[model samples]
Target: MTTSEQLHLPAGSTGRGNYETIIDPGAREGWVHTGLRVLALAPGGSEVVTANGVEAMVVPLNGACDVAVGGEDHHLRGREDVFASATDVLYVPVGSQLTISSKDGGRFALATAVATGSHPVALIRAEDVPVEIRGGGNMTRKVRNFGTVGAFDQMDSLIACEVITPGGNWSSYPAHKHDETVDDGDHQESELEEIYYYEIQDGPSGPGFGFHQTTSSGEDKPIDVLSEVRTGDTVLVPHGWHGPCAAAPGHDMYYLNVMAGPDPVRAWNITDHPDQTWVRGTWESAGIDPRLEGEAR
Candidate 1:
């Protein structure tokens, strides 16, 4: 058993009123900015979202849908599954009516932040999603930037992205932390709470599984989480060094990351662990794994 299974929320464990799965900052004591909601709809089903003080990003986890926001319908051509390809997304600013409907049944994930910043609504297409191949060798993985910082900078605090690690590979490598708030106009990590929502690809035998690790960074913010994550499972990072998630030999892994913080500047600042920082240097010589090139296409 991994240390501190307290942070691991298995599938169907966090359901609340109206949503099948919901995680809200206001609902959790001491958590201030981030929120996530998973909504499932039957064919021809519809619902209005009441995210009054929050800016939200609608990501379709499976199947297609139409997002009605700002008096317009933003049709999303969602993928068959998370492992297929990057899906379309919609951004809704605060104080707006957000409604979603699908002719065919599917599930959607709403990544949100408690914010008041003003930004126009955007209908981001799937082809426009930036695909990044990061790390090298077995540490290699593909990152899809949908609501990430530089990719889509309309919101105030929300920063979200998708990562796909091939079978038998590792990602979020060389353990890193972004738990300290520093403002000297120089180097310092920003404090942010992160959410990792996982979806593992199935193998020939059965449903897939993987291992996740997040330990303390010795910065007084203690955390210890070693979880065997599966589809629809989630892990919360309040503060710690998180990295080196391992996908089982026959299973590929996909995780959507939702992040937000108290900082005014919308930036992702992180500090790699001193001991494993050296792993980055090796990437200079190590080429990317060939399997990712085909899958990312």
Candidate 2:
């Protein structure tokens, strides 16, 4: 009963079938009826063959990497500081044998979920967890908590967050929806089930742009995806009205929003698409994404 497919890997583009390069998602193919899978690692080195079943998570979007998982080995570095929590979300367990290495290169964002019944835990990274900004002046958002916020209990299925919408401003602006129900009045519900995963900022001769929108449950039905994203592009929000409009006129737009669902309660309910719901009161006055001046890799 879940339908919405758009998986585009435009950066070298590897082998497999439906847009290949999958480091093993239980042999792919609609990935076990959408158990959730995302991989676009290709920089200097890569090796992740979870050949027993599935249960993986090694996220990093630019520079530094060295994970061995199961056999033990973790190290993810790269940050100008914007809520830094690069890499190390490994939880491979299903005959586990995950391996990854990058000697000063970049690009590595992998997220897999499929443990037959479920049982695989091991995460390491114990310090320097700072990157917070939740609603303040234009609803400014730049959170980065990286794993273990109750470890797999925001709906028990693994969750992740890394949002940064600084350019022309607007990060998920109003237009929201978590499938059917969860969170009401100012929205605050749970039923987890999401995935934004995007990256842009190549302008100034680099070429990178962005634009995303979805709506088709009435409410003026609209689905415009004005595309032009860089660094292993990906945009999927199984539900509806997902927003990402950081028009890179100068450069400053990053997205890394991964969510899980089944309703165990992790809180984050949204439902505002009645004509954009008045653009969330026009963000008070709108101001903050003025190219977000340096800092935050």
Candidate 3:
């Protein structure tokens, strides 16, 4: 993998004994403040996860698991996979430790970020997650707001969420950026470093693939990343305008987005690229792709 490819981690590239992939702030020099780790285990397998100074959420991408935090065990009724449904999640605050074990083998994601203050451990139920369909027609997609500023009000800097785009459709359209803090009355934007961990469903015949692009929002900072992503791949956005994550003709795409930064106030404010802002108006007439139902299934 090239340096850029390194940032776009493919499955199995960062595997350690029990973990399938690991990307921490320490691993990325220029990148700071956010981290992620994917753990996979066999039946009756378990791993001890601890947050030294960082706060993390135990999100089950596939299968149910038990998270033991602060001497209490919380059973997470997870889904068969990201496509199945929104799964239960557990929040682990800074300076805390936990153990996650699964009855049957499955995978879990630890979405983390640097913390400024401490918070009590919280269990977020799947039904409590606000499920919404954003955009319309082909651009339509499902969003599970489990760890956003408005969804769960307990984190310090971390903002996490998930999106599912049906095959042959686009999500995160109209390239937008949040790399700068803009605080003008009603107009507000917060600087945030983001990570996109993708999982593509199988095509009719074989494996599946998708695409993601991130380019410099302006002349000052030139960043470019266009990758053909597969299941278990990740794209990091340190700074730029990112959008139009497209799922292939027969492959649906699911991504877990983890974001955080130095911003004192945690908010997701973004400025769309001037060239792509017009796309929003078109969505009104385009009608959402029928493949995506109005509600989360």
lDDT of each: 0.87, 0.52, 0.88
Each candidate structure's count of clashing pairs: 0, 6, 4
Candidate 2 achieves a global lDDT of 0.52
What 10-residue stretch in candidate 1 is worst by lDDT? Answer: 1-10
Residue range 1-297, candidate 2, lDDT tens digits: 222334333443444422223433324443231233343345666766553544555665656677776657777664422224444444555456766777755555555543445555555442443455543354465655564254344223455666766555556766667665544466564544455556666666676666655555444433344455554455555555666445454555666666655554444556666776775565446643333323232
Ranking by TM-score: 3, 1, 2
Predicted candidate 1 versus true structure: per-residue lDDT over 1-297, tens digit per residue: 224556788988997654667888777765778888988889999989977888899999999999888778899999899988999999999777888999997999999888878799998999999899988888999999999888999788899999999999999999898887876776777888898999999998799999888999774777789889999898888888998799998899999899999887887889898889898887758888888765443
Winning model by TM-score = 3
What TM value does model 1 have? Answer: 0.95
Q: Cα deviation in Å at residue 112, candidate 3?
A: 0.2
Ranking by lDDT: 3, 1, 2
Itemize residue pairs with steric clashes in candidate 3. 136-288, 137-287, 137-288, 137-289
**Candidate 1: pairs in clash:** none
True-vs-predicted CA distance for residue 64, candidate 3, Å: 0.7
TM-score winner between 1 and 2, please give it.
1
Candidate 1 vs 3: which has more TM-score: 3
Q: Give the top-scoring candidate (lDDT).
A: 3
Which stretches of candidate 2 lie above 4 Å from their native place? Answer: 1-56, 63-66, 72-101, 105-156, 159-174, 177-202, 205-244, 250-252, 260-262, 265-270, 277-297
